[model samples]
Target: MPPFVLRSPEVLLSVPTPADIDRIAVVCTDPAIAEWTTVPSPYTRADAETFVTGMVVDGWARETMFTWAVRAPGRPDGTVLGMMAIGLIPGGPGDAHAGEIGFWTAPDARGRGLTTAAGRLAADWALDPSGLALERLQWRGFEGNWASRRVAWKLGFRYEGLLRRHGVRNGTVCDDWIASLLPEDPREASEPWPQEAPTS
Candidate 1:
């Protein structure tokens, strides 16, 4: 476990500093991430640098995205385990009260439920009045990414529908699994919605 600082329940998210970029980069560049996500294949240090400097900074400065650094459970700055992003939230003047959540973990950190935990935390914060005006939290993932879909389902996101040819990954059009959690739903529950998978 790694040390970590929680974002105010109001903010619902936190940003990773440049110091955490290297470890994050290692995970982002892993074959699993590239294979499942829109992240560029052969992800490099340059891409990682952009995420820490240009992208994260610019998104924050412009209020386009809300992000968090997922640290190892007990170590605040031990290493960047992965990251989470709340995309397209209704924060700007003309924005709507909707948001999409996204996250990825290091290959070494996979299957540990960090993502599911982070999702619950972020969603709980996002739906609070002090945070974003999230009437709904949406999750969209490539159809074949069972791990990602599992995370969303574990967080009580109901599968709403599928988007055919909804996203392009490496020049290939892929279907997407679309899901959403309503503000009235109970988030942060140890148990999932009845329709969610039954864990042994």
Candidate 2:
């Protein structure tokens, strides 16, 4: 699928460009991002360049994954607030009508509803009949990533359960917190939010 823009009254979701490489590199260097995501530890400028110039370009051209940068409406592309992705899970004929949703927020963008807003826009597009027409959307994160869970929660994703050692984070095995949303699911959360364990 060709890259396109998804917009809301407050946020705009558009393609990430080479102009975003430096910002992406810096945001990805944060320990929290590396700890919770599969992004390389000690993420580099070269990695960022490859992400925008290589991976992103190929994903769109191949129609395997669609990615977007979340920014405030009318803002320059470099002032990205976050990134979002919708990846088609190839499974043959019907493709199971399934896709996975993923996102990461820039450090300064945390604690606001920006990620949720952007994700909602992208997800709605993916699920629309005129869009990807996906039947199910899966969301996964490291087991302890409450921040990510919170966003998924707000997007109406229902907690599915933890997957034992089902994911990898920077080469380390990790448990995955999984969730799913169907086209029939409510626009608001389908169930009560799960409580997070004490950090201390």
Candidate 3:
């Protein structure tokens, strides 16, 4: 599939380019992002350049994964707000349409719903008949990643319980929370989302 762009009222999603290396490196260095994601610890300029110029470029070229750099609308060419991607998940017979979604937001961009918006756009595109025609988009995050789980929930991904020691992250086995979104699911929260009580 050829690379494409997606835009919403507040954000723009485009394929990452070499120009984004500096920002990518900066964002990936955040301890929070590094802890919850697979990005290398102490992310470096070299790593960011390789990711943008090599992994990202090759993934799109092979049509095996689609990654987008999220930015604010006013200065779409400026700093990246986050990154989101949807990639093929090899499946067994009768499950060829499976795909997976992953994302991370810059520290400054968190709590503003930028990643949620970007995720919705990517999910819609992936499930559209005119797009990848994927039957479902799966989402997974470390067990304690309530922020990521909340984003998936807000986008109507049905909670599918936890997978014990399902994958490795930062060199350690970790449990993951799983969810899935289908084309027919409503694009709104599917269950009650309670907020923490205010601190005294």
Clashing pairs in 2: none
Give the runs in model 3 whose Cα sits over 4 Å from its true position.
74-76, 92-95, 194-200
lDDT of 1 at 37: 83
What's the true lDDT of residue 167 in model 3? 72
* lDDT against the true structure, each candidate: 0.73, 0.88, 0.87
Q: How many backbone clashes does candidate 1 have?
A: 7
Write one digit per residue (lDDT tens) for candidate 2, span 1-200: 67888888878999999989998999999898888888888999999999999999999999888999989887546497889999988882367588999999998988878899998998898888999899988899998899999999999999889999999877879899999888888767778887789999
- Candidate 1 lDDT over 1-200, as tens digits, reads 12224643222235687887677777887778898788877888888888888877776677656777876555455566668877765563336678888888877767777777777777876677877667878999887777888788778888788899998877799888898888887563334443544556
Q: Which candidate should be chosen as best, given lDDT against the real structure?
A: 2
lDDT of 3 by residue, 40-74 (tens): 88899999999998888888998878998999876
Error of 2 at 157 (Å): 0.5
Q: How many clashes does each candidate structure show, in the order listed?
A: 7, 0, 0
Task: Give each model a TM-score.
Answer: 0.83, 0.96, 0.93
Model 1 ranges with Cα > 4 A deviation? 1-14, 89-94, 188-200
What is model 3's C-alpha RMSD?
A: 2.5
TM-score of 2: 0.96
Error of 1 at 114 (Å): 1.0
Instruction: Select the stronger candidate by lDDT from 1 and 2.
Output: 2
